[model samples]
Target: MDVGVILLTLVCYALACLLWWQLHTPVFLLCLLSGHVGALASPLWVLLYGVTYRADLGVWFDVLGQPVYSSVVIASAWFYPLPALIILYLHRVRWLGARYTIALLTFLVMAIYHFIIETIGLGLNIWSYDAAPLLPFGLSHGLISTALAATISMVLLYTVLVVQRFSLISMVLSLVPATLVFSLMIQGVLGAPFWVSLRFAESQSWVLIIGMLSTLGLLGWAVHIIAWGMDHMNWELV
Candidate 1:
């Protein structure tokens, strides 16, 4: 019963609903959809790191009597929607473009945001990232991993919205399992190295370090892909 997190989640959901009602736009709906997807998909990352790299949630409620934390699950509802908010804000300001500037800026913002939240979670005993290993500045592997997930997902979501132009069909499609599928795919792909190293390597000391570097390299590649995709996309907003 992490009261603070629960309250924050409620506020986020309420604000999103209010905005959607007032604006009647697809972006807010996208945020809400992303939140739902995050709630479902967020725990998978924890499950990965928990088994391999040693992350843990505090004594919160579990899913299906499993070790999953309810706090972790609910916190994701707020976390995942943030990228949609970023995309919407960037699009509104005409700052959304196919360039390194937009992609890098988005990545930095997401990374900082993820790092801060993870640090706070660690401080609050909501989770632990110290068991296996840590990055510099006492950062957790989850920081880069999640930021990459969000940034890549944001870019892909933008591409989808641009292609579909928020048509009624597109709206319906984007607001459901499609978002979940992509979210999972992005996370799974980006997180594979770390999981593999920790899962299979008898001595994960060097392998984990290599895995971390590989994950960073993949993140850079993903960012580059975002820029390339943005360049190819036509600016057709319906």
Candidate 2:
């Protein structure tokens, strides 16, 4: 990557900060970041799927349908989601009903935006398509993945923010850890693994599987808890 491209991206993000002000604070920015990180993680699936295939997957490139640029962006997208999830999880614990619903809804909303971008990627050949049915929300490879991510982010964030009554400063501070954790996740997803656990997890293979399942469960529980709170408490959406 050239310094110019990096500089340009930084500017884009700075614009994104401005855009956030025009939008809904860090929440909107988190949605965009999640989408970008997810795209970057495409290489992870490629490596696993490529090796299992009998033929060569070919060099990762932009034109050849495996562009390194897009891959990095996707992995970058993955970084924002965890904090969103954490935020949502907290909301569910404190008060479920509508606040949790808002959190849940925002997560899904973010995923939808992410899916639109991913759909564009598939068309651009940023990654190889291996759909058995090729339907959205089926194999979870295309736009469906986008929807899922957005939904999860919103729901989770809603719960966390409402439950914790987080101040802007704390929410912003949380992003630091989120970025660190996800940067590592993205690295692992891209075969780099800045941390040993990611590399070791790759070796075990089941580690990633367990991690993903646990994430799913935690997310689901978050939604469920919010439901419980909603029923028990008379929380209404503002």
lDDT: which candidate is best? 1
Candidate 2 ranges beyond 4 A from true positions: 1-12, 15-71, 74-98, 131-140, 155-173, 179-238
C-alpha lDDT of all candidate models, in order: 0.60, 0.44
User: Candidate 2's residue-wise lDDT over 143-198, tens digit each?
Assistant: 33443344444443433344334566765455434443443333343222212222
Q: Model 1, 130-187: lDDT tens per residue?
A: 5544554455666665666566456545554463347666766665555556666666
Model 1: what TM-score?
0.76
> What's the alpha carbon RMSD for model 1?
4.0
Work out the TM-score per prediction: 0.76, 0.42
* Model 1 misplaced stretches (Cα beyond 4 Å): 51-65, 93-98, 133-139, 149-153, 156-164, 200-204
lDDT value, residue 210 of candidate 1: 78
